[model samples]
Target: MVRLNCVLLIDDDEPTNYLNEKLIREAGCADTVVTKESGEEGLEYLVSCAEGNIALPDLIFLDINMPAMNGWEFLEEYRKLDESIQSQVLLIMLSTSLNPDDHKRAEEMQEVAGFIHKPFTTITLEEILEDYFKSNGN
Candidate 1:
């Protein structure tokens, strides 16, 4: 069996983070699950890891709206990172918003791997893992 990758979850909702972290862990989709309450903190963590040549997470689950910084703002900063380090991470936007514009914008972003609705379940985690493996040619 392939070893699961590390996951970085960026969401402001405490319950959502707790539940998603539980589901992701139970689904065996990640070896380590790191969560940040805001996009700014998430970006700071990534930037620090990049500077130290540390292993970056394989995926990032970002929420659209947060107190510190929104997902759009995170992406804007993420784009400024060195291409080598930037290319190592895959971003997935997770939001409760049912807005078509949000989905469209996420699709347009090259760094975004996919979009998932809020309150992720085991089934969704399984699908995400499958997709991730397939994309990585595993």
Candidate 2:
């Protein structure tokens, strides 16, 4: 098993965050799982990492319908971040929305590694580890 150094989750739903954090820990997928309630907080975390010489997360799971800064808005600002910081991150959009436009928008975005529906699962986590992290049959 390949354990990621960090995984950052940005979602407004506290229960969802709790469940996902538990899943990640139980799966032995990450060394640290940081949860932020809003996209603004997410960006702030990233910046703080850059300024404070802290390690940035290798993966980020973001939600689409946050209050302060939506997923799309986060990406807009994320694009402006230095390539050194941005290049090392793999971003995925997690949403409960069944909107076709949302799917299409996610597909069209170069920054998004994948768009998965809500209820982030253990299988999905394994698949992501295999697909993106190349965990070698994790």
Candidate 3:
């Protein structure tokens, strides 16, 4: 398996982050897994990484319903980031929202690689890994 350097989970729900982190660890698909409670924190992390303060994540699993800054708001700011940083990271919108509008919006966003429902599973992790890593000859 081609392990990713880092995986980031951005969600206001603590339990969701905990469970997802555990699942990602068990899957062994990434070397590092980071959990942030808000879209703002996630964006700050990305900025810090871009400034060489930390390592950039290979993938970001972002929740759509955060309090201060929602996933959509984060994407707006993310678009302004340097292209070098943007090119190396992939974003996946993770949400429990069953709204078709949410899915459609995510699909329309060029930066979003995919949209996944909540409760991250090993099988889903494997599928993402295969699609982004294995198929890419990583």
For residues 1-138, could you state the per-residue lDDT of candidate 3 as single tens digits? 878989999999999999999999988888999999998899889988878757799999999999989999999998898888789998999999999999999999999999999777888888888887786766
Segments in model 1 whose C-alpha atoms lie over 4 Å from true places: 135-138
Better of 1 and 2 by TM-score: 2
Worst 10 residues of 3 by lDDT: 129-138
Candidate 3, superposed: residue stretches over 4 Å from native: none
User: lDDT tens digits, residues 1-138, model 2?
Assistant: 778999999999999999999999999989999999999999999999998989999999999998868999999999898888888899999999999999999999988999999889999999898888875344
Instruction: Give me the runs in candidate 2 sitting further than 4 Å from their true place.
Output: 135-138
The per-model lDDT (C-alpha) reads: 0.84, 0.93, 0.91
- 31, model 3: CA deviation in Å? 1.0
Clashing pairs in 2: none
Give a tens-digit lDDT track for model 1, residues 28-66.
657899999998889888988888877888888999988
How many clashes would you count in candidate 3? 0
RMSD of each: 1.6, 1.7, 1.1
As for TM-score, the candidate ahead, 1 or 3, is 3
